[model samples]
Target: MGKLTRRADFLAANGGFRAPTPGFVLLVRPRGDDDPAMRLGLTVSKKVGGAVVRNRMKRRFRELARLVLPEAGIAGADHVLIGRQGGIERPFEQLAADLRRAIAKVRK
Candidate 1:
Protein backbone atom coordinates (compact mmCIF):
# COMPACT_ATOMS: atom_id res chain seq x y z
CA MET A 1 0.00 0.00 0.00
CA GLY A 2 1.57 3.26 -1.07
CA LYS A 3 1.26 6.22 1.27
CA LEU A 4 -1.18 9.00 0.50
CA THR A 5 1.47 11.68 0.53
CA ARG A 6 -0.49 14.19 -1.53
CA ARG A 7 -3.46 14.51 0.73
CA ALA A 8 -4.50 17.91 -0.51
CA ASP A 9 -4.28 16.83 -4.10
CA PHE A 10 -6.46 13.84 -3.42
CA LEU A 11 -9.13 15.92 -1.77
CA ALA A 12 -9.12 18.51 -4.49
CA ALA A 13 -8.97 16.42 -7.63
CA ASN A 14 -11.28 13.54 -6.87
CA GLY A 15 -14.97 13.16 -6.30
CA GLY A 16 -16.39 13.98 -2.90
CA PHE A 17 -16.66 11.27 -0.25
CA ARG A 18 -19.40 8.68 -0.14
CA ALA A 19 -21.05 7.00 2.81
CA PRO A 20 -22.53 3.71 1.72
CA THR A 21 -25.33 3.22 4.21
CA PRO A 22 -24.28 1.43 7.39
CA GLY A 23 -20.63 0.52 7.28
CA PHE A 24 -17.94 2.76 5.81
CA VAL A 25 -16.69 6.20 4.97
CA LEU A 26 -15.26 6.43 1.45
CA LEU A 27 -13.34 9.43 0.26
CA VAL A 28 -12.80 9.27 -3.50
CA ARG A 29 -10.27 11.30 -5.39
CA PRO A 30 -9.90 11.12 -9.14
CA ARG A 31 -6.86 9.68 -10.91
CA GLY A 32 -3.97 11.88 -11.93
CA ASP A 33 -0.69 11.43 -13.78
CA ASP A 34 1.45 11.69 -10.63
CA ASP A 35 -0.77 9.48 -8.56
CA PRO A 36 0.94 7.04 -6.27
CA ALA A 37 0.37 3.28 -6.24
CA MET A 38 -3.24 3.13 -5.15
CA ARG A 39 -2.54 5.06 -1.99
CA LEU A 40 -4.71 5.15 1.11
CA GLY A 41 -5.24 7.60 3.99
CA LEU A 42 -6.76 6.49 7.25
CA THR A 43 -8.26 8.95 9.71
CA VAL A 44 -9.64 7.96 13.08
CA SER A 45 -11.09 10.93 14.87
CA LYS A 46 -10.58 11.71 18.55
CA LYS A 47 -14.22 10.88 19.06
CA VAL A 48 -13.15 7.27 18.70
CA GLY A 49 -10.62 7.40 21.54
CA GLY A 50 -7.14 8.34 22.62
CA ALA A 51 -3.99 7.53 20.63
CA VAL A 52 -4.08 3.78 21.30
CA VAL A 53 -7.66 3.27 20.16
CA ARG A 54 -7.31 5.47 17.12
CA ASN A 55 -4.10 3.72 16.16
CA ARG A 56 -5.78 0.35 16.27
CA MET A 57 -8.49 1.51 13.89
CA LYS A 58 -5.88 2.95 11.60
CA ARG A 59 -4.09 -0.39 11.58
CA ARG A 60 -7.22 -2.24 10.60
CA PHE A 61 -7.88 0.20 7.77
CA ARG A 62 -4.33 -0.23 6.52
CA GLU A 63 -4.51 -4.01 6.47
CA LEU A 64 -7.83 -4.09 4.70
CA ALA A 65 -6.83 -1.43 2.17
CA ARG A 66 -3.65 -3.34 1.33
CA LEU A 67 -5.55 -6.54 0.76
CA VAL A 68 -8.38 -5.01 -1.27
CA LEU A 69 -7.23 -1.88 -3.13
CA PRO A 70 -4.96 -3.37 -5.75
CA GLU A 71 -7.51 -5.98 -6.66
CA ALA A 72 -10.03 -3.18 -7.09
CA GLY A 73 -7.68 -1.38 -9.50
CA ILE A 74 -7.23 1.83 -7.52
CA ALA A 75 -4.36 3.08 -9.65
CA GLY A 76 -4.03 6.85 -9.86
CA ALA A 77 -6.76 7.31 -7.29
CA ASP A 78 -6.52 8.38 -3.67
CA HIS A 79 -8.82 7.04 -0.97
CA VAL A 80 -9.13 7.99 2.65
CA LEU A 81 -10.72 5.48 4.98
CA ILE A 82 -12.31 6.98 8.06
CA GLY A 83 -13.55 4.87 10.89
CA ARG A 84 -17.13 5.30 12.05
CA GLN A 85 -18.06 6.30 15.58
CA GLY A 86 -18.93 2.72 16.41
CA GLY A 87 -15.72 1.27 15.14
CA ILE A 88 -14.44 -1.59 17.25
CA GLU A 89 -17.91 -3.00 17.49
CA ARG A 90 -18.30 -3.23 13.72
CA PRO A 91 -18.02 -6.63 12.10
CA PHE A 92 -14.83 -7.32 10.16
CA GLU A 93 -16.57 -8.78 7.16
CA GLN A 94 -18.86 -5.79 6.94
CA LEU A 95 -15.92 -3.47 6.97
CA ALA A 96 -14.26 -5.44 4.22
CA ALA A 97 -17.38 -5.35 2.10
CA ASP A 98 -17.74 -1.61 2.62
CA LEU A 99 -14.16 -1.06 1.49
CA ARG A 100 -14.67 -3.24 -1.54
CA ARG A 101 -17.74 -1.23 -2.45
CA ALA A 102 -15.96 2.05 -1.96
CA ILE A 103 -13.14 0.88 -4.18
CA ALA A 104 -15.57 -0.14 -6.84
CA LYS A 105 -17.30 3.23 -6.74
CA VAL A 106 -14.09 5.17 -7.02
CA ARG A 107 -12.72 3.03 -9.82
CA LYS A 108 -15.80 3.82 -11.82
Candidate 2:
Protein backbone atom coordinates (compact mmCIF):
# COMPACT_ATOMS: atom_id res chain seq x y z
CA MET A 1 0.00 0.00 0.00
CA GLY A 2 1.14 3.53 -0.70
CA LYS A 3 1.19 6.26 1.94
CA LEU A 4 -1.51 8.88 1.58
CA THR A 5 0.34 12.20 1.83
CA ARG A 6 -2.18 14.71 0.63
CA ARG A 7 -4.66 16.42 2.95
CA ALA A 8 -7.38 16.23 0.33
CA ASP A 9 -7.03 12.46 0.15
CA PHE A 10 -7.57 12.16 3.88
CA LEU A 11 -10.60 14.42 3.71
CA ALA A 12 -12.06 12.33 0.93
CA ALA A 13 -11.65 9.14 2.91
CA ASN A 14 -13.20 10.81 5.96
CA GLY A 15 -16.36 11.27 3.93
CA GLY A 16 -16.45 7.66 2.82
CA PHE A 17 -17.55 4.39 4.39
CA ARG A 18 -16.68 4.00 8.08
CA ALA A 19 -16.13 0.85 10.13
CA PRO A 20 -15.41 1.14 13.81
CA THR A 21 -13.29 -1.50 15.48
CA PRO A 22 -12.25 -1.99 19.09
CA GLY A 23 -8.86 -0.43 18.47
CA PHE A 24 -9.53 2.10 15.72
CA VAL A 25 -11.96 3.47 13.14
CA LEU A 26 -11.40 2.58 9.50
CA LEU A 27 -12.46 4.84 6.67
CA VAL A 28 -12.37 3.90 3.01
CA ARG A 29 -13.24 5.51 -0.32
CA PRO A 30 -12.72 4.40 -3.87
CA ARG A 31 -10.14 6.11 -6.05
CA GLY A 32 -12.33 7.44 -8.81
CA ASP A 33 -10.16 6.75 -11.85
CA ASP A 34 -8.91 3.24 -11.29
CA ASP A 35 -5.51 3.77 -9.79
CA PRO A 36 -4.51 0.22 -9.01
CA ALA A 37 -2.71 0.96 -5.76
CA MET A 38 -4.26 1.30 -2.33
CA ARG A 39 -3.26 4.27 -0.17
CA LEU A 40 -3.18 4.52 3.63
CA GLY A 41 -3.44 7.41 6.06
CA LEU A 42 -3.24 7.45 9.84
CA THR A 43 -4.82 9.84 12.35
CA VAL A 44 -4.06 9.95 16.06
CA SER A 45 -5.94 12.88 17.47
CA LYS A 46 -4.93 15.00 20.47
CA LYS A 47 -8.10 13.86 22.20
CA VAL A 48 -6.60 10.40 22.48
CA GLY A 49 -3.53 11.56 24.46
CA GLY A 50 -0.48 13.80 24.69
CA ALA A 51 2.14 14.03 21.93
CA VAL A 52 4.19 11.09 23.14
CA VAL A 53 1.20 8.81 23.43
CA ARG A 54 -0.21 9.92 20.12
CA ASN A 55 3.07 9.29 18.37
CA ARG A 56 3.25 5.84 19.83
CA MET A 57 -0.21 5.07 18.60
CA LYS A 58 0.68 6.33 15.14
CA ARG A 59 3.73 4.10 15.08
CA ARG A 60 1.62 1.12 15.92
CA PHE A 61 -0.92 2.03 13.30
CA ARG A 62 1.84 2.36 10.69
CA GLU A 63 3.07 -1.10 11.53
CA LEU A 64 -0.41 -2.54 11.33
CA ALA A 65 -1.01 -0.88 7.97
CA ARG A 66 2.20 -2.29 6.57
CA LEU A 67 1.40 -5.78 7.76
CA VAL A 68 -2.25 -5.92 6.79
CA LEU A 69 -2.74 -3.68 3.78
CA PRO A 70 -0.57 -5.42 1.20
CA GLU A 71 -2.54 -8.65 1.35
CA ALA A 72 -6.04 -7.51 2.30
CA GLY A 73 -6.42 -3.93 1.15
CA ILE A 74 -8.67 -3.11 -1.77
CA ALA A 75 -7.04 -1.88 -4.90
CA GLY A 76 -8.07 1.54 -6.22
CA ALA A 77 -9.02 2.82 -2.79
CA ASP A 78 -7.79 5.00 0.04
CA HIS A 79 -7.93 3.86 3.65
CA VAL A 80 -7.55 6.02 6.71
CA LEU A 81 -7.08 4.49 10.11
CA ILE A 82 -8.15 6.71 12.99
CA GLY A 83 -6.53 5.63 16.18
CA ARG A 84 -8.47 5.39 19.44
CA GLN A 85 -7.29 5.16 23.05
CA GLY A 86 -7.56 1.39 22.90
CA GLY A 87 -5.00 1.27 20.10
CA ILE A 88 -2.19 2.23 22.42
CA GLU A 89 -2.72 -0.68 24.77
CA ARG A 90 -4.25 -3.36 22.62
CA PRO A 91 -2.32 -6.50 21.79
CA PHE A 92 -0.64 -6.43 18.38
CA GLU A 93 -2.35 -9.60 17.17
CA GLN A 94 -5.77 -8.34 18.19
CA LEU A 95 -5.13 -4.96 16.59
CA ALA A 96 -4.20 -6.70 13.34
CA ALA A 97 -7.34 -8.81 13.51
CA ASP A 98 -9.42 -5.73 14.19
CA LEU A 99 -7.95 -4.10 11.09
CA ARG A 100 -8.72 -7.11 8.92
CA ARG A 101 -12.31 -7.18 10.13
CA ALA A 102 -12.72 -3.45 9.62
CA ILE A 103 -11.38 -3.69 6.07
CA ALA A 104 -13.85 -6.43 5.26
CA LYS A 105 -16.72 -4.40 6.68
CA VAL A 106 -15.81 -1.27 4.72
CA ARG A 107 -15.52 -3.21 1.47
CA LYS A 108 -19.05 -4.46 1.90
Candidate 3:
Protein backbone atom coordinates (compact mmCIF):
# COMPACT_ATOMS: atom_id res chain seq x y z
CA MET A 1 0.00 0.00 0.00
CA GLY A 2 1.09 3.56 -0.63
CA LYS A 3 1.79 5.80 2.34
CA LEU A 4 0.04 8.94 3.54
CA THR A 5 3.44 10.39 4.40
CA ARG A 6 2.85 13.87 3.03
CA ARG A 7 -0.60 14.17 4.56
CA ALA A 8 0.80 13.05 7.86
CA ASP A 9 3.51 15.66 7.57
CA PHE A 10 0.95 18.37 6.97
CA LEU A 11 -1.24 17.26 9.86
CA ALA A 12 1.69 17.36 12.27
CA ALA A 13 1.89 21.07 11.60
CA ASN A 14 -1.75 22.01 10.92
CA GLY A 15 -4.35 21.22 13.55
CA GLY A 16 -7.61 19.63 12.39
CA PHE A 17 -10.36 20.27 9.83
CA ARG A 18 -13.69 19.06 11.08
CA ALA A 19 -17.23 18.58 9.76
CA PRO A 20 -20.25 16.70 11.07
CA THR A 21 -21.77 13.40 9.86
CA PRO A 22 -19.49 12.64 6.92
CA GLY A 23 -20.74 9.51 5.16
CA PHE A 24 -17.66 7.28 5.13
CA VAL A 25 -14.08 6.88 6.26
CA LEU A 26 -12.47 8.06 3.01
CA LEU A 27 -14.03 11.47 2.49
CA VAL A 28 -12.21 14.81 2.68
CA ARG A 29 -12.60 17.89 4.81
CA PRO A 30 -15.17 20.44 3.76
CA ARG A 31 -14.35 23.70 2.01
CA GLY A 32 -13.12 26.47 4.29
CA ASP A 33 -10.89 29.50 4.37
CA ASP A 34 -7.58 27.81 4.87
CA ASP A 35 -4.34 27.80 2.84
CA PRO A 36 -2.14 24.96 3.93
CA ALA A 37 -1.68 21.62 2.16
CA MET A 38 -4.31 19.17 3.28
CA ARG A 39 -3.51 16.62 5.92
CA LEU A 40 -5.60 13.70 7.17
CA GLY A 41 -6.44 12.11 10.47
CA LEU A 42 -8.30 8.83 10.93
CA THR A 43 -10.69 8.19 13.78
CA VAL A 44 -12.32 4.86 14.43
CA SER A 45 -14.77 4.85 17.30
CA LYS A 46 -15.00 1.92 19.65
CA LYS A 47 -18.72 1.78 19.12
CA VAL A 48 -18.10 0.87 15.49
CA GLY A 49 -16.59 -2.44 16.44
CA GLY A 50 -13.94 -4.13 18.56
CA ALA A 51 -10.37 -2.95 18.80
CA VAL A 52 -9.24 -5.09 15.89
CA VAL A 53 -12.02 -3.85 13.71
CA ARG A 54 -11.34 -0.26 14.66
CA ASN A 55 -7.68 -0.64 13.85
CA ARG A 56 -8.47 -2.26 10.54
CA MET A 57 -10.86 0.51 9.67
CA LYS A 58 -8.26 3.13 10.52
CA ARG A 59 -5.70 1.36 8.37
CA ARG A 60 -8.11 1.23 5.49
CA PHE A 61 -8.87 4.92 5.78
CA ARG A 62 -5.21 5.86 5.94
CA GLU A 63 -4.33 3.74 2.98
CA LEU A 64 -7.17 5.14 0.95
CA ALA A 65 -6.15 8.66 1.87
CA ARG A 66 -2.61 7.94 0.82
CA LEU A 67 -3.74 6.72 -2.56
CA VAL A 68 -6.16 9.56 -3.18
CA LEU A 69 -4.65 12.61 -1.44
CA PRO A 70 -2.19 13.59 -4.12
CA GLU A 71 -4.83 13.93 -6.80
CA ALA A 72 -7.10 15.67 -4.29
CA GLY A 73 -5.05 18.92 -4.56
CA ILE A 74 -6.56 20.10 -1.31
CA ALA A 75 -3.96 22.52 -0.16
CA GLY A 76 -4.12 24.32 3.19
CA ALA A 77 -6.67 22.27 5.03
CA ASP A 78 -6.53 19.73 7.78
CA HIS A 79 -8.57 16.63 7.01
CA VAL A 80 -9.85 13.97 9.32
CA LEU A 81 -11.64 10.77 8.27
CA ILE A 82 -13.97 9.25 10.80
CA GLY A 83 -14.86 5.61 10.36
CA ARG A 84 -18.53 4.72 10.82
CA GLN A 85 -20.06 1.36 11.62
CA GLY A 86 -21.43 1.31 8.11
CA GLY A 87 -17.96 1.49 6.62
CA ILE A 88 -17.29 -2.06 7.67
CA GLU A 89 -19.78 -3.18 5.07
CA ARG A 90 -19.31 -0.58 2.36
CA PRO A 91 -17.35 -1.25 -0.81
CA PHE A 92 -13.83 0.20 -0.98
CA GLU A 93 -14.24 1.63 -4.48
CA GLN A 94 -17.30 3.59 -3.44
CA LEU A 95 -15.48 4.83 -0.38
CA ALA A 96 -12.61 6.02 -2.53
CA ALA A 97 -14.99 7.77 -4.87
CA ASP A 98 -16.67 9.45 -1.94
CA LEU A 99 -13.28 10.69 -0.79
CA ARG A 100 -12.54 12.19 -4.18
CA ARG A 101 -15.89 13.93 -4.25
CA ALA A 102 -15.32 15.33 -0.80
CA ILE A 103 -11.95 16.69 -1.81
CA ALA A 104 -13.38 18.28 -4.92
CA LYS A 105 -16.10 19.99 -2.89
CA VAL A 106 -13.67 21.24 -0.30
CA ARG A 107 -11.31 22.61 -2.94
CA LYS A 108 -14.11 24.80 -4.22
Q: Give the per-residue lDDT of model 3 (tens digit) for 1-108.
A: 212346554454234333333446334443365546565666677889999999888888877878887777466555667787788777788778878776666555
Sorted by TM-score (best first), the order is 2, 1, 3
Better of 2 and 3 by TM-score: 2
lDDT score for candidate 3 against the true structure: 0.63
Candidate 2 off by > 4 Å: none
* Lowest lDDT block of 10, candidate 1: 13-22
For candidate 3, report its TM-score.
0.67
How many Å off is the CA of 108 in candidate 3?
A: 3.1
Q: What lDDT score belongs to each candidate, Candidate 1 first?
A: 0.70, 0.90, 0.63
TM-score of each: 0.79, 0.94, 0.67
Which residue pairs clash in candidate 1? 14-29, 14-30
For model 1, how does the per-residue alpha-carbon lDDT over 13-95 read when each residue is reduced to its tens digit? Answer: 34665645354477876556774666677777898888888888888877787777778745676677777777666877778
lDDT of 2 by residue, 1-108 (tens): 688899988998989999998789999999888788988899989999999999999899999888999999888999899998778889999999999998898878
Candidate 2: the clashing residue pairs are none
Alpha-carbon deviation at 74 in model 2, angstroms: 0.6
Clashes of each: 2, 0, 3
By lDDT, is 1 or 3 better?
1
